[model samples]
Target: MTKKFVTLDDFLGTHFIYTYDNGWEYEWYAKNDHTVDYRIHGGMVAGRWVKDQQADIVMLVPGVYKVTWTEPTGTDVALDFMPNDNKMHGTIFFPKWVEEHPEITVTFQNEHIDLMEESREKYETYPKLVVPEFASITYVGEAGQNNESVINEAPYDGMTDDIRAGRYFDDNYQRIRK
Candidate 1:
């Protein structure tokens, strides 16, 4: 039972832009970090949280075939083949508080974006094709939930990824210079 278009091999070990239904996008890649749970070798999925460009690796289980992340939040975030279609579809989750929705319809494509300050100059701005492709990963919000709460409630400590991303604000709640 093989699917059309992309397959397991084609989707893994490559770079793709993960687009969420709420218009949030991240540059994604993966590596098999040898951790096991329930016989599933954990896959470390690295996603750059584009707002300030911080990349963090999150553990996802049941990933050898269809990359699933359910252990972290007790909510299953899975990636599966889009039936009757050719692209990959699934629920993409970020580290702990970064993503709080049950899940968001995540679409992965061959689209790539280099967040390096120097690399951004290589291409001319094109019309965003990623915007229209985001469909709700959740059955509830067709557009998914807003990410502000997750960002706001996240702890502002030196250990947090958000702190490294320079997303902190002043005592008055104004964004400080990164």
Candidate 2:
């Protein structure tokens, strides 16, 4: 039998964020060739430790994710998340111990920041309650090297295609409010 790989959306959409009392911890590189301990909080992405680069993106997806971390004192930290509130949050805790690392540079990636700004602009223009008809769903799955599943889905019912397509905003236009 061939193993089937499911798209992130399909796998996550059906799940719920699991929780635990024990915190999770992991090592991440500091700017100065030092390692910092990160604590995982509850109500956020699971399995992945806090301060993990991929954890941020995992939270953005529409699904439940959980995370756990163990502190220096041996206390456990946990985080849970639901798909709806995932994108609303960013990096959680950045400990002072890790800040001393000279090799670690804490900063947002240019591409991610740009995409976030664009999403904010669209959200402001169309209230969160109103799902735009032109909103596209990014398919993370790949069928082949050249082809992927990314495509835009139709906007809300009764909205015209033109309206949906017209509402599309360019990434360059969104200014970082902060």
Best by TM-score: 1
- Measured against the true structure, the TM-scores of the candidates, in listed sequence, are 0.28, 0.21
- Per-residue lDDT of 12-125 in model 1, one digit per residue for the tens? 333233334454433323322211111011122222122211222232232223444433222234554332232345554433322322122111111223222122233322
- Model 1 TM-score, 2 decimals: 0.28
Which candidate achieves the best lDDT against the true structure? 1
Give every collision pair in model 1: 104-137, 105-137
Write candidate 2's Cα lDDT for 35-72 as tens digits. Answer: 12221222222222322222221332335434444332
Compute the lDDT of residue 136 as modeled in candidate 2.
Answer: 18
Evaluate all candidate structures by whole-model CA lDDT and list the values in order.
Answer: 0.29, 0.25
Residue-level error in angstroms, candidate 1, position 101: 11
True-vs-predicted CA distance for residue 141, candidate 2, Å: 4.8
| Stretches of candidate 2 exceeding 4 Å from the true structure | 1-63, 70-80, 84-91, 102-178
Q: Which stretches of candidate 1 lie over 4 Å from their true place?
A: 1-7, 33-65, 81-87, 92-178
Every model: Cα RMSD to truth: 19.0, 17.5
Q: What alpha-carbon RMSD in Å does predicted model 1 have with respect to the real structure?
A: 19.0
